[model samples]
Target chain A: MDIDMSLVDWSRAQFALTAMYHWIFVPLTLGMTFMIAIMETIYVRTGKEEWKRITKFWGKLFGINFAIGVATGIILEFEFGTNWSNYSWFVGDIFGAPLAIEGIMAFFMESTFIAIMFFGWNKVSKKFHLTSTWLVAIGANLSALWILVANAWMQSPVGTVFNPDMARNEMVNFWEVLFSPVAINKFLHTISNGYVVSAIFIIGVSAWFLLKKRNIVFAKKSILVAATFGLVTSIFLALTGDGSAYEVAQKQPMKLAAMEGLYDGKTEAGLVVVGALTPGKEAGDDKDAYIFKIEVPKMLSWLGYRSGDAFVPGVNDLVYGNEEQGLISAEEKIERGKVAVQTLTEYKTAKDEGDMETLAQLSPLFDRETSEGQEFYENYFRYFGYGYLNAPGDIIPNVPMVFYSFHIMVGLGFFFILFFFLVLWFTVKNKIDSKKWLLRLSLLTMPLAFIASQAGWIVAEVGRQPWVIQDLMPTVAAVTRLDASAVQLTFVLFAIIFTTLLVAEISIMVKAIKTGPKENEGGK
Target chain B: MNRRNIFARVLFFYVDGFRNLSGWGKKLWIIILLKGIVIFVLMKLLFFPNVLNQNYDTDAERSNHVLETLTKSK
Candidate 1:
């Protein structure tokens, strides 16, 4: 069976692009739904017409976001079977459980309540209707939670065991996997980030309204609520981001190395903020032959190990020679390096080698029985013939996407702190409405918050690069073999449908915002 | 107490509690349910699988066994 590597690459690329685009709307739905619930509950409690107006306004937006989220999400599920058939088969048992539960428990609860929340306003009592809204919010967040759990499992697989008999991985205990450290931390970080995204979204839109002097009463109140939420969440996010980085360093050293663009182990590594990593170069170079260059400071160790003097391996260290001067024999170390190099070469060659015997030997060694061998092989393979092999003992992360994304996310985090603080200061001093420029800037910053949240997630997921589940399974090995054409067709179809849904959502939201909530004819 | 009197007393307590809850507690409860129970439980179930005891050593091995079982059944 001849498999075209281009086709797989194309399909995978399409899938990632589509999923990412779809995800832009998902966290908003999850976070905004909760915010809407809060707004509506406030209305129900205070019986203030203003709160009701706020509730109705945000509810409309949530509805639109939710629809787009659902539409885009459905496409991803199909892609797994169609594009990654082998992956489905490989981790289906462990992977299928969470997805099934998500569908049956979380999806069902969320969808059912969402319908009630949307259409039940007139039919149900105020209390029942409010309850429905709360349920819908619960449902949406639950959906995110379940999906993250599945992703987290992929990030840090737990409670599973190797079955030499079955020649694959299988679930051993469901409980152990659920409570894995990675899953718990990732879940908190993701949901909190979602909240931050929604808060920024609210602040941005409200600031725009204030700048325009439209719905001043509602906009002021909305901004107050949103800014408060955004400020707090941003602070939380900064802390969580730190913790997540620490975890990444511990579990995914390669990803950490990639993020910092470290080519050699050093006592103190500088954190590169915004720099181009030219794939095959030394730290200091002036020409095209310069491979990987990054800004340096000892910040990597400070962040990852919490000590400036901590030793962090660079790409070269991981690939080449990094042993105690006399701890191990030189011959043995070279042999180890050779084995690692051979494994990586075999895997890559098998993709294009067309030799069955060589592939057979290479493939099984990458299996559970010899994953250590696979890792060593991959590290060496990365060093050999890559033109950037001069500092072979360094560890390089396949994380160009993550490195930039992380910085962008962190940069935005600080931006929000300043933006919200200024808004709060102005508002308290009764000068918020008087300052049109600040209002406009605040309004514009909302999308930036959402962007930061999305980018943060991208870094978290993409940084894990080669592993689907940390050290347990490599993504390449997890993929299923289905016709690439099928994946392409589905991807195109989804792209069209999702775009339409997004357009419709925006139109509806625009109409709702323009119309505003109707004034109560007679105080009910 | 007489049935009428008992009903009246119960109604008074219910209205009083409702009024208090309507101010802020209701809103807080809703937020908690949405963020805490719904999202937390779902994410836990999906992203983090329940790892039962098995004879295998690695997650990949266990995953393969499960897949084989499912395939065999299919």
Candidate 2:
């Protein structure tokens, strides 16, 4: 029954590595598929050969990116069973449904129409091919939606009941899980981030073409579409980001505390406008961890609760109880969780012995029909993850990592807004292709977009800390009992293979772009 | 004919397909197959350890241990 800490760490590291690599291509695929569709739609409407050429060119790049994304994504799906077999078993009852549904509904939709969009140019009717292109875009996004819903459920588990006998969480209300506020906000936020990344990518590459003046007209038109799209999605990304913060504040206050590096309870805690934290600072003991910090007065409260004066419990307050915030200590939750765990065990033994009295008493704690039963269930069942914890401090996530990642992501988000605005303005002035410095800046934003996307994931995932499913299971308890060396070997293998695929993908994309769109035989 | 002949025919085609490849293509295919085997079989057989299932032997025993730990109040 001993949990190997090293195995858990290595497994987590492996998943993170694969996920980050998978993410590099996914956002672009999500963004560019729709861009190509838009171009084709224009071609369909205007009957312009130029629009068709543009669509075909971008579609080529999209196909290359899509292939590697599919390859890495397949690996990720299997790793769930291979590395995290325990977590797969524990929550598979509820978790497996969305993934399976995604494969049936979204993946099928994408993979089927993708061929038509790529190779059916002269074979199919223009209208039908256009429809297929749009379908590919819709399918890719729908796939993202389902995957995010699954991840969001892990963050805020809903519509599920704990089945002690089966030793797993089972879905009770699929609708609740699908439509939970967290899932919806996560979908909106994540997809908008994708759109913004794609827009930046287009603008950057178009800037390169403009600098060389190879495809000036095509580059300008592409920049116009991407910049406008980027600007709108950037604004939406910021708004949904606020909604995400509010959800975290409500469902995972400790994560919020880690993200902001808030260590002391306050009624109106100021938001860290810009901050630098001291290295190796511990919460509860190190009060002044911020080496340099700027604050916006009462902004955190207003953002989190829609009120400027609402009490927000800090990290220390959650680890050690805060009376004002009505927060109980993690230690207290551990004790309650232990009771719940013990009660279930005894109940199992009684059932084995055919003791009806003990069964009746224990049944109320698991039942949710009556008011008393619901209260008991809420009080003890909610803290189930705490039972596995040895100390209250184990609940605290790596604050410095979450804090820096959040700031970096937000900073880059604002920068993108400004960058897109300038690009759009210059295009209107007829100077977009003429400005060499601005083109270089636009080109630089391509990598920055990826960095921001990765940072966003780090903030969301690492901020959740020990819990894989918040309050239900700690990651240490959820990893498969595999040897650390096995995980390390697989991790290295995945790293090498994925890196090779990434290099190949980039080289092919560069070559495609260098070749440019094929000339139309009959038209300019 | 028989199952063995059918298998041999399939294997022959697979090997011939590789043999027909250019030098670089052949090398690339070999590298890919070697990596696949190392990842799928050799690594798993030599390194991957499954102690959780081994230790408890049964679900009932594991559940019992977890319950005992939880109920043991300080």
Candidate 3:
């Protein structure tokens, strides 16, 4: 079959660009919603007039972020049919389940409660409104949870069966898919990251207000709430980041290798803290084509396997080498690789020919040969595919947009940990106002928080290149055969509409923030 | 009761019950919708024995047996 790599690349690029744009507001929506809920809860508990001021102040920002998020998110769903028709068809059986649930369950719940929470402020009692706010927060996070489950299924594919006849994967056991180790870890890690992003967002905005001396009471209270949440979420991010890296090490060694820029497996893999990764003949040569690199201690192994001695596959090993480097016979490795290639080839052929019998027989063969018992063989085969399909060894996750975005996100995360702690310390000493520089810095950090959140999403989505569902279907092969002109038209239309909405949202938010809370507004 | 008084009483009960019961009702509604759509789609698409026979071949017979068991259990 003939393949148009350019079309696939173009479609992927479009999707990645769209998704990155959409995600800029998502984390803020997730984090700010919860923070606003907390403020409202405080208002409910203590009947604090100041707390109510804080809630109303932040809730305005939350509403802006939520509106933008909703507007951007709808484009992504439409693109499934418009851009990725084939992918939608291939994994529609499994993928559609979670998405349908997301729309029917989470989206409706969130949108419904959000309206009640936003508009019912004067009409409803404080307790009822507060409950609605909490539900909105839950609905947003729950939306993330189910989507992650579906995504993690694509990543690890648990509780699913390969229907050789159907030419697709099917959910055989829903529980297994839901409880897959990778999904659970990813769920925690992703939600915690959202928390971090949101907390940083609040802190940044609150800091801005403090610096401006516009709404001192609201700013101080908001920053205090944000800092407390930020500090706790930072801790969770660090821990779950570790867990996620460990899972990646176990499941997707290639991704871990790409992230760390590890070229070869070594006894003590140096963690690249920050450095340029230049493409050249020699590793140490400083040339014009310098790539980013940063080196830390034996943190890679420690993070990957919880032990320094653990061997994590470097990019070079996975991409260039076939042998396991110990105990595995070269002949056996070659034989196993041949069998896998044969199985995959036959499976595809059988699928194409609509020969269910041959397809079914080939499915278990690949599965058995790829499981734990066949690690040595499986590793070599995978390495071979990695080399053949994605060569140059070092050019993986080649999307500069994804790579830099991931780095920026991680960098911002570290920045917030320090920033929040500093704010917390100053607030404790009652010298927050005096530390005007810190306040200014916090204000400046708001856009960075949004950028980081957006970047994190870019990395997650773009890093899983080629596959809409890993190993099952290539993303390019999954796209609908629509004329590029049609997509271009829709893209232009969406861009205009989205831009208008964003401008309006920002204007409204700016006005609300400038207004401050009304004195007799009572508890928010 | 007078018309106004009766109307007020009904409104009070509706609002009171709605505030208290809305949360649980929302959750239940979500669960029902998720299950209903999935079951309906699955039945429409795959429940037909002829479609299964055409699609799965030898596996179709086994799947049919399983489907029978599933329906019996229900």
Candidate 4:
């Protein structure tokens, strides 16, 4: 079959573009909802008009961001059907469940409480209003949790079985899929990053007020809350990020190798601190990929494998296979994947011809308790996506892109931690207002935070290229067989629509921020 | 009788609410609408073809092809 590479590329671009746009608003909503809740909680506890003003002020911004987030988010969910109809049918049974649950359980919860939190200020009791705000925060994070669980399943397809009759993966054990270590770690890490984004936003906006010498008391109090929250979550982000890397090393060694720009397998690989890539470096080029490199000694192995001298397979090792590193070649995996595919086809043909005996024989291949089943799935079925590839080099992701994005994200992450620490310290020392340089720096952090967040996503999504669901289906096979032009056209359309909405959102938010918090307008 | 009274009358009755917008505002609003229509309505109607529905007449056909792709050795 002739695969439409253009269709696959456009479909991927469309999805990635929508996902990125959706994320810009989502992280803010996720982080700021809780910040607003915390502020409202203080308002309830202290009964201070000042605290109430801060809560109301941030609450207004949250509402603006949330409205646009909802709009962008709905498009992403629908794109699974519109842009990737094949992916929808292929993994819909298992994938759709979590998404549906997110909608029914989490989205509704968030939207409902948000209404009450915003509009019920004067209507509800103080304690009740605070409860509603907290509920909204919980609801938003719970939404993230379910969606990330779905995404992690794609990254590490667990507790699911391929049914040839349905031509799809079906969940046998919901618990395993929901509670997979990948899902849990991703949820924690992603939401923590959201917290960081929110803290940065709060600090940046407050810094603007400080620079202008307007709303000094309000800005100082906000800085105190945001700084503390940012510091705590930034630490969690680091820890969870470590867990995420470990999971990637275990499940997707190719992705890890690409991220580090590692070409040769090593016993104890140093994690790259910074590196410059040689131009026009191909995956199989004899020359070194990195022109000049700086790395932390033995850190990659220690971080990825919890050992100082663990064997880590590089891109070349994965492509060529390294017996010493216990790495199998992509060629071998592809061969096995073909066999798995052939067997399934034969199984289907037999079933079509009413061959019950053949069905009985094929049944053991899927049976978890059987040794033969375990060997077949663990060896061959696990690398089923390789069956669709034409060359072993197709297994290599864009190394330079992944490597740079990873470094940028990590660098910004550490920078944020230090920034938050300084801000918090200054706030405690009563020198926050006087530190004009720090205030200006904080104001600059908002865009930097956004860039870091986008880069992190690019690493995760682009680093796992060619596979919509890792090792199960290549993106070529997963896309809807549409006219490429049709997809390209719609891609442009969505881009325009989303951009326009984003501009409107920004304009309204800036106007609101410029109008300082009202005094004595408690609840009303 | 007054300018404010006349402005309110036009705002309440006009289709584009031109009285509510300045001269530049009217032009910008029209451009935004035109762009929105071209993108959301015209492009979707013309270019958003249903490839899946066209290629496979039935779910069984699509499923069979997918299964074959997975199982057929390259």
Using all chains and alpha carbons, the TM-scores for the candidates as numbered come to: 0.73, 0.89, 0.77, 0.90
Best by DockQ: 4
Model 2 is docked with a DockQ of 0.09
TM-score of chain A of 1: 0.81
Docking class of 3: incorrect
Mark the 10 consecutive residues where model 4 chain A has the least summed lDDT. A67-76
True contacts kept of each: 0.05, 0.05, 0.00, 0.25
- Which 10 successive residues of model 1 chain A have the least lDDT summed? A381-390
- In model 1, the Cα lDDT at residue A110 comes to 57
**Model 4 agreement with the true structure over A247-276: per-residue lDDT tens digits:** 999988888998899888787789989888
Which candidate, 2 or 3, has the higher TM-score?
2
Q: DockQ of all candidates, in order? A: 0.05, 0.09, 0.04, 0.14
Instruction: Estimate the lDDT of model 2.
Output: 0.81
Q: Which ten residues in a row have the lowest lDDT in candidate 2 chain A?
A: A515-524
Chain B TM for prediction 3: 0.34
Q: Of models 3 and 4, which has the larger lDDT? A: 4
The candidates' interface RMSDs, in order, read 13.5, 6.4, 15.1, 6.4
Alpha-carbon RMSD to native, per candidate? 10.6, 5.9, 8.9, 6.9
CA-based DockQ, model 4? 0.14
Docking class of 2: incorrect
Ranking by DockQ: 4, 2, 1, 3
- Ten contiguous residues with the weakest lDDT in model 3 chain A: A383-392
In angstroms, give how far residue A412 of model 4 lies from its true place.
Answer: 0.1
Error of 2 at A197 (Å): 0.7
